[model samples]
Target: MTDENTTVPARPRGGLLRYVVAATLARTADGGAVVAIVLLVTASGDPGWLAGALGACITAPHLLGPFVARSLDTTRDGRRVIALASVVHGATLAAAVLLYPSTHAIVPAALLIASGLLGPLLTGGISSRLPAIAGPSRTSQRRAQGWDVATYGVGGTVGPTIVAAVSAWASPHTSALVLTLGTFIAAGFVMLLPYSPPASDARDVPRPARTLVVMFSSGPLRRTLYLTMIVAFSVAALPIAAVASTDQLGTDDAAAGVLTAAYGLGNLAGSIGVMARPLEGNADQLMTRLATLVATTLLAVALAPSFSLATAAYAAAGIANGYFFAATLAARNEYAPSEIRGQVFVWTGALKITAGSTGTALTGAIVGTAVHLPLVLAIALTTAAALTSASERRFVTRQVRAADHVQPGTVRRD
Candidate 1:
């Protein structure tokens, strides 16, 4: 059944541009916090463990994503919820900046965790609103998703650059303050968004656990989630492999930096390409192809004889990474039920973050043992993702064909 509240009016001439700007700012705030925190911790002469602790604090709130999204789902006006979250997020960041000089760890930790709780407003919340802004056209939605992915790439690249540049000229505290101000600006942008409230339906809302169960029970969504996690793990391992490649080449750490930048450039290029011309094929199939490309490139990087070769391979992998991200978002929109779509997006984001964090820690532990181990492991994971996608496709196709063959009046029991 179509939900009237969810249906966007015919495309307004400049509606999409407004949403793009809002989403970009939101992503910038998200990425800026990460860069600002790292600089802040480093400049304070804190132990490495403090930095790690801060990272955990930032990511820990994501564990509550489903619950948060559930609450949002209960409300008709998601935009208001998102706007409020953004304000709270900005306020907490501002508080963290003001309290940075305190000797106690608890104050900063608590503030950071409070800010992190609003991360979904910037990420999945914005994404969930895309369909509304893009109207009912599939092409428009695809373009919007592509732009969304590109904004993420841009934010990740620009946020660190801004923090690093400011920190170089001034103090890390100054950079943190700047980022805190930026968060407020982002909140302003979010509040300006024109999304209508999702239409309330008569269907019963499932409990969070039941919603999760229904989501995972769907073949396509399950495969997509698995693919997202595997790809995230591989992407996280890239930095570990980049460091190892520098060691293998007996080169300066600058080589690793260059390699990392190469990947980012490729990711940006791929995202732009998708924005210009969206992928053509089944979402699952496109995802499978992209995962295969990532796996193959990682394998090549592992075997690369020179730093140059490794850099090229990593960049290639990153291009595939960008496309894969877009495909997965599209898949989520395609496969998830409307009632729980927000939860699904938030859940997916949390899982990807968790997988990436876990992969980074694992890679750190093992990369010292073998220069190529991280890349090899990444390749294995991507390969498994591809296989899983292929299996899902076959299973779904069988189910469709079987249903087609069944008599009209008779129900077939599985």
Candidate 2:
């Protein structure tokens, strides 16, 4: 007879492939739009300030991700909602493309902002469905999350490359149109995916304020968010540092692109590795270790004597960064309750975007300083985050052990 505790492995679901492809296309469109917008604005003879404003407009709606994702949580058919949003977002991009050249700044900017408002459907909505797609097993969920991270990395890398290649050969307008087409294709795939809304549990539901409180109350969740924010800030400093490093080393601007590509390649490799060899030990501990590795790599980048060494260091940092992302996602899956998982995912995305944008802005202000200063600052911030994670781990361990000793039916006050 089979042991009562044994679990049979779940058969892989085919819908998962469709979901991954759809999500990847959405992300690629989103990433390509960034590069396309810059190129289009520049080609239209707009000032740098206008391009920056448009970029901010595109990203600003992501700050409302939690609120926007609430509709997804409440809807009876999440796939339909996601598909509809994707279509609308794509249409907005198409409109922007048509109006980019001769139209006033306000028109395209408004269109871009409309698309941004639908961003949560593409990101958090899709991610929240991973558990359902991969079955109820923890191992399957972890593997699905790893694949999600890898897909996102691939989309980000491919999107910018497509824009660069198209803009060099054709025009930015063509690139924008291509990206808009991608979104439409993604919408079609989303509609084809087999998704059924999860059964509602009244006991699982919590008020938004209560949800926020609970998320922050968990040591693991709180520490994960903090660590993600710190890492995001550091990552934002990379581009500026890349440009500065090329100049300091007497290399052409192409060197900056090469360094960025190296980092992206490393991220892709690390994400794939996570899928192949699952992480062991507590999720929180694994995340802390990865964050520490990122810090060490950043420090090496700061002190590198040559551009070649700096590129390798950045690549190493990227590997750690990718693994940290996978670990953080796993931690959230393990720690967050089912009802509020969507909110948590969207909230984390918003926070990381805000932090990274702020870091980029600040780094821009100090770009004239020493070339390595931003990397040094990133090292300090990441190191602090690692230490914070360690302290939180100890506190959580103590709390768990104390709870274990409490007798049944006795009031155990903290």
Candidate 3:
């Protein structure tokens, strides 16, 4: 729901800046851990299926993000919780990287799941406290929210690029392990933040079912959720696509990361550009057009005549996706019911992670020595997303007006 004029507390701005840095690093560390796991397993002759499985394990916790964030909000020692969560996130990731080979699936999957559950603390958990950090007025809070949104966009795309690029030149296992240290660095910053969790009331935490009902009742919001999920699912597979594409082209395996890094680069560029110059009107319409573009580019990548052409097509799809991500963010805020404004961000962010996990798993199952199937499937999903863009006019506004209205928890922009 839109908080067109939401105000902020007169807290100092200093912590907000530090929180942003910590959140960015935490995101980077998570991405690095996932890629590191995938690379480690695939290099050791395990089927790529485990790679997707691990990705999903990390993402599943997002489904429970609101509850977890709420729980954190009630505690007086919220700063410690955030710090401990960060450490746990890194520790679990590092354990999986080091022990996945010997323990196989179950233990490592559990570790990743634990890490994923802590994800909200480093991201949405902190973002919710923004009113206190940004200070004095709603406009300042909104500006802060904008930065959080951009960080989410960049973190999602860049983490893979950095890790994959390093793997291209260094030991995948060692690089993965080294990258996990960033989480500890993030923990240090989080520990220092002045996180005074607001006095909590258990009665205020919206039931998960109620939150889900609210989302489903709004047609535009529902479609946006589906769009976010499908887009995420499709993008998650690109890493594996890199491996499959290289195999099909019989290129040096070391260069496979170039394809992955290219997509990340394009996505980062597109998201940043859009944020700098906000789009003019009709966010849903923009989403439809950009989603179509994304599907078309994915199709192009699938049928490209050579490895180089495929890489270019892949990057094009990423750019279109970046634009779509921005549009989706706009659509969510515009259409989400005012009653549930608080919960929208974190819940949807969870859905994105969950969708990504599904995408990664599906790709692992079907991916072989070619990129055709995964890219084609991505095209199909994005096409569905395009078709799903439009909804009955005023439907969301009507739903909000009629909603039984619960003031939910803080917004998690990611």
Q: How accurate locally, in lDDT, is each candidate?
A: 0.79, 0.80, 0.71
lDDT of 3: 0.71
> Model 3, 8-109: lDDT tens per residue?
344654787787887788777765666777787787888888787877687667677766654554456666767787888888888877786788589989
In TM-score terms, candidate 3 sits at: 0.71
Give the number of the best model, judged by TM-score: 1
Candidate 3 backbone collisions, by pair: 1-336, 1-337
* Model 2: lowest-lDDT 10 consecutive positions: 1-10
- Candidate 3, residue 49: CA error in Å? 8.5
The candidate that achieves the highest lDDT relative to the unseen native structure: 2
Please, what are the lDDT tens digits per residue for candidate 2 over residues 242-347? 8878877678888998788778888887888788886766888988999999999888777777888978987987888888888888887777776777777777
Better of 1 and 3 by TM-score: 1
| Candidate 2 segments exceeding 4 Å error | 1-12, 199-210, 403-414
> Higher TM-score: candidate 1 or 2?
1
Cα TM-score per model: 0.92, 0.91, 0.71
lDDT for model 1: 0.79
Tens-place lDDT digits, model 1, residues 330-389? 888888887777778888887887898889989999988887788788888899879878
Clashes of 1: 0
RMSD of 2: 3.4
